[model samples]
Target: MHIQIQPIDYSIILIYVAFVIGIGFALKRYIKTSADFFLSGRSIPAWVAGLAFLSANLGALELVGMAASGAKYGLATCHFYWVGAIPAMVFLAVFMMPFYYGSKARSVPEYLKMRFDERTRCLNSISFAVMTVFASGISMNALAKLLHQLLGWNYDLSLWICSGVVLIYVLKGGLTSAIYTEVLQFFMIVLGFAPVVWLGLKDMGGWVTLKEVLRNVAQDPAKVGLAHDTALASNAMTSAWQPIFSGSSANLMGVDWFAIIFGLGFVLSFGYWCTNFLVIQRAMSAKDMGAARRTPLIAAVPKMLFPILVILPGMIAIGLSYIGKDNYRLPPVAISESAYPAAVETFQKFAAGRMNATATTAALQTIIKPKLSEAKIAALLAADSQQKLDSSAIRNGLQDAVADNDYDGVILSLVKKYCPSGLLGLALTALLASFMSGMAGNVTAFNTVWTYDLYQAYLAKNKNDAHYMWMGRVVTVVGILLSIACAYVASNYSNAMDIVQLVFGFVNAPLFATFLLGMFWARTTSHGAFFGLLGGTLSSALFHGLTLPAGSTAGIKGGWLATLTVFPSEMAQNFWLAACSFSACLTLTLTITLLTKRDKSDNELTGLVYSLTPKVKEHDLHWLARPAVLGTLLLLACLILNIIFW
Candidate 1:
């Protein structure tokens, strides 16, 4: 479970950390105004902005969460990138980036203010600022947990050290520092994880053997653990398309094509990629409109290929467990009888990840039934197959429970098992970079939005730019501190990825609809935009309140009202929540737009609204070099990859 950090390895990590701090200090001279601190002075080149755009997202969300999901959902986890990311990213590049960059608004919320009104801007800024901090906190939590679990470092101390390095760099260099650092992190991650996939696949006798090993794990009952479904276990694990083709019964993600397509692909994907300020801030910092439009497009090329670096490691970890080359095993997660009912969703998640829901449920049954008396088991089974097993004696009977694989630790554990001393340092550094990048991306975005969108907009207009720049630095510390507090909040969750998507559903899903209407539909009034946003957010909360996931209690995961419906899994719930939010927001925005008067004239909407603005024509050498052309090629490439995998 732990990697022994040699002195050389420690030296490598320390050197990287020192360089990170040095970059921040070096960039300190550039911070004259709030814009300089927050926006990188709009001077970054396209390629740098593009990589920074992509790297901003490569944090723990990619390195750990994707690996964890890959371990849990099998190949279907690729859907997050192939379905959920590529298309949205393309949309951002080709369609949305123009408005974002051309409007000259400091942040996404400022764009909303420019297009709509102050109330809308205020609402978005507040929510975005809050969400960024929480998102930042999740990254911090993942980093701290990684260090604590793998290196046996103190958890609290890890949080401080990780956050401290990021704080120093971001505090000095601001977005400029974070962006360049993210570029470095990007290469580190690739260099760090590329070998992981190579070493794993090579050890298992390459690609064919990797699949065979995974297939073996999927079909074996003893190895299947809580996974009970045997029929499509291999298919679900090995083939992404097969599970959906067989319907929800075989879908490893517990979501049908409709939910996968509309919920995750369209709603959640577009919501996060287009509107979330973290990634958008990178694009928004581009030197010109052409570079801005190209920022996400440039990032898309590598993004399409990142799964190999991230997801394969997790799959390799599981496959390695079945390989006789090493004594390493997937880390085990113990579920107490008291915690089992609450952890039903968690258990089914990874068990089903072995391939299909039936196996997960059956394996879950196998783990518990052995400890309970026949009568107690019967009673529990009679009441919804042990889901509502709340009796004291029944819980007492289930004292000796089984532990599941710690899916979240799959990638980090791989580093421990397979990597050599020096390579281990690079891998560790790469992981640390990803964690810091994700955290810094959020913190940078948070400070910007807090400074320009919230503080200057309403708090104090009389404050000079120097004062606002000072506030930006202050909020950097404030954001990281708050993120530390939120890390403890994140520590409660079983899946960091699921919680992130859930947060996006609440904050970003409805907001995308707002942007869509405001940009393209010039008729969308401030009243419509503001209330539509409110309606969408409320609907998401309302929907979540009414519906509970199958293996969960009635709490934050939903059913706070009454359990009107139950989703198959938490992932499914998150998808549907986003879908509902988007639909509600769009409908409400349209309905309210139809009823309300348009406050802004066509003149005022000129650069802000897409339809009202002139078509962007880049003064470039060739058509292929243009953002749209590049974007089209990227989409085609993405489609080809999807089909090849399918």
Candidate 2:
């Protein structure tokens, strides 16, 4: 925690802030109409959209979470980067983006309204708004927590600092401003983290030392890669240690395979890439359909490389710990309510000498000083053994400090202890930039929905362009305030990411089902879209409520409801949740379609459905088929990984 914040860090951050604000105001020239504000006048270049998409997705959550995963899961956590994301994105570029762009809709709900009816659009818009709010709030909370932890700033102050920066840019330039800022951030953050990771690897004695370290930790001198124990499996706790999904008994729900592949891979991927307003909005701003389609694909290649910068350093950190016990320092101290031993022999000596606040702090520093040194501070680690590794010192020292808690503190400790001063500041700045990108995207999406779908559609149906633009600005400010309040509320929640993703699933999953049916099935009715959405959402919520238990492995399995882990023994939690919700909603959609009087044809819709029914322009349907193919291939690859790990 003894980070020396240099003036250079402050300077860099200040310049970065000014540049962001400047971009926002500069984009004011582009804000000629509602279309321009929301979609960059639909004229953003593909290259810009590509960078923005990457930046939007690579926010603070991914940076911290990937690092945490590296500390916990070793090389296998990179699956999220490669197996999960790359193919999904390629799918988005080739298949989904065209559908969205060809539809020529301003927003996803607007597209839905064109595809279904007014009722469906309204329902989707509200759900999307709520989801965006929850997601943005938690992400903001994450950014604030990291800022406080890294900079010694107050959490509330950090929250405002973050909100202020994002607001200026997004409010000034709209989507155009957000996209350009995102591109700048993409470069700054990636550049900031890359060298730190490279240096950390060097400190660990390079790749040769890294192999030995991993071999030692695995207690297998021959095996060079990450450790795998098929017997260990992918339970909540076990997945933390082993990257492989099927090594343990915890893969009972096929979560090891199915959850990542079908559930996370297919459902979550498409939802974010094609449907989520925050991400798709970047594409929507493209000057034409081609730029929109190519932008995400361009982003995909960089995203594939991002995990290395984000995750590998933490793995190397853990590996470093096993190389030489004396040379390797203990991780951070974890506090718990457990009563401290009244007088440990070692502590008694310090206490007897009357170690007060300054003395106590100094003593702790002395103990940790060796850990900060540049040299390989190896000492006589074992008396009875030739191996210069002291297991007792390392284990006993860390065990007392981190007793009963998980190893989350370890990674943070390493960052504080080893990362250099300027780099530390840069990293913190990068994290802030990353955090703002997410918050900005969320706020932008929320504002767009409020302005177009709700305000234009209902509140001020006949408003002039100037009035609408002003309203958009006002709603954005109000949304920012609401987001801050939500962030404060979210700070009290446990496992904030898990909560965010799950609530997101509960709300957004039904919409996914509705949209998919609406797109593929012509029999899909307005009534179908309405009840399908309702049934899918309610059923998912019920399923989540009834079955999910404490300490679940799947990301979407934790909640306040999970605390009461009492359920019938017949069904796996996720299966019932997914199946019941998907089936119920699907059936409801079909039943409603059959029951309802014929409303209108796809010809009546303004977007992609128009192409289907010859209502809109007939350019090409080939692009729309690509995501389906790539999704299938990605799903297969996921299965193969599962089998290999199993």
Candidate 3:
């Protein structure tokens, strides 16, 4: 498992780190006030902000988790982008950006305060600030773990190195430095992964050969670790739409089309892209409203093609495993005398868990015969037939092996195996770029919310601009330190994506409901907004708690008050969780708005709510320059992709 790091690779990484720091120091002169520090003086261009917008989101979770999901679920994993992301990006550009950009609100929570009340803003600010810090930490932890696993670096050293680089750049130039570096990181990632997909496709004999090999692997029950059945596995791995509507247990994703459409496509997608300040801050920093409106749309072009870089690596890994690639194939070993009983017990437990004991026994024989003595295997099978062992204890032991789902490590494996020393360094640096971009984005967002929303608004009202600017710098340092602590905490969790989605279910899912009501429905009272937000958050917590027993092993354990239900899979549960929370927030907000008084007048609500806002005249602009036109084009592209993949 040890990988030799070449001098060239280390040098490339060092150069990347220095270049990032240089950018930070280069932009330090621009920060004369808190606004300049946090919002880049609201003067970034559409193209720059657009790439940063996408890069801010192209973190360890998107890179590692999406690839892992691709290996596990096949082409269906593209749903994370095609279905769950693009439409939302377009929606934010067309409908939400007008309020987000034109209102001149300092942050997303600040907008909530202007539209709703201080309580609602506070709720959002505190939750968002906390989540960003933790998310930054998660990115740090994932980077450290990857470096340790791939390059033989110490975990703490890796954590310090990565976090330090992010802190220097973000602390020096603040958002401007972060955004510019993010642009650089975006290119780095593209250069790094592009060759990986090319090499992989070349090795696998192109797309057609790869798909045929995958289908052949699917038909073999002995290769069931990659997929279940011939028809289901082949279609799930090759086609997106074919298996989406199948029963829960039929498809690899374990959710039907209903959940994918309403839950993921509509609810969770809009919630994150529209309401999450981590990304919205990027667009808000644009030089003008038109630039802001175009940021997400501009980002969408690369986003549509990202699956080839990220998800395809996993698909390639799975394909490589079938072709006996040294890194992808399982290693050979003979069972030790002491380990024989334990291994046999593991196979027996797997057998007993299934209803068809005869078929299970046959499968177990095929898997274990090479590693175990016939007598030992026979003894275990006889013991299982007689019901003479505790299936739970045996199952627990087997779970230990299953828990090491190193699907996330497939990309790292590809890098070490296929990349030469110089290229290896570049590839590794791309990973470092993704981690730093994720961390910097979160830290920048956290500092702004803490400074403008909480400190300036509540803790120290009427503070001088210089004082707040100083506080912003100080918070930047504090935020990175706190994120390091959170990174350590995150190390205890299993998969990066699962924990992130859990946080989204609790926070983003319901918050979007409040934003949806506030932006469109002027009748939404402050009380309705506040309580509905509270209600949505609680419902998310309740739904998550009820499904804890059925949730991913990666989730936080033992805090659930009760397990009232089970789910087909964690992803399906998460989608439903958002759907339920969104419905709860929408229902509560509407009902409470009807019962409460309208606190803000139409004049006060001008430019904030849709009905109260004046119509924007766009006839003067060229068709391509119009946000509506750009948004429509993006939506059409997404539809075509879905149809082709379908």
Winning candidate number (lDDT): 3
lDDT of 3 by residue, 324-439 (tens): 76535422222223444655554756556643545544554454443223343444556666775665544333322231246667788788777888888899899989988988
Residue 54, candidate 1: C-alpha displacement in angstroms: 1.2
Give the winner by TM-score: 2 or 3: 3
lDDT by candidate, in order shown: 0.80, 0.65, 0.81
Candidate rank order under lDDT: 3, 1, 2
Least well predicted 10-residue stretch by lDDT in candidate 1: 369-378
Candidate 1 has which clashing residue pairs, if any? 226-363, 227-359, 227-360, 228-359, 228-360, 229-358, 229-359
Best by TM-score: 1
lDDT at position 23, candidate 2: 89
Candidate 1 structure quality by residue, lDDT tens digits, 1-646: 3578898888889989988888888988987877889999999999999999988888886678888877766778888889889999999999998889988988998998899899999988887887778777777877787678668899998888888899899988999999999998888889987887788778878878888877776666245342434445676677767677677657557778888889999988898899988999999999999889889989988999988988887777777766645776666553443555644544434433443444434555655533222333333344434354444433433332333566777887878877899889989899899889889999999989998888887888888788998999999999999999888878876566455646556877787889889989898999999999999989998998899988789876889999999987777888888899999999999999999887999999999988889989777548788877888898899889888878
Model 2 lDDT per residue over 1-646, tens place:
3457788878878888989999898888878887777778888898899889888877777777777666555555655655567766776666556667887788989988877889988988887887778777877887676556545678899899889888888888887898899999988888877777787777887866675565455443112122233333223221222433443234222244554555555655555666778888888888877677777776876776675688777667667655543465334333221322321332334434544434433444354422111111111112113432243443344233331212333434455656677777676677778888878888888999989999899888988888888888898899898888888888775566456667667666555667677776666788888978787888777767656543444234533354445322112344335545666777889888899876766566534542464332225646443434444554465455445433
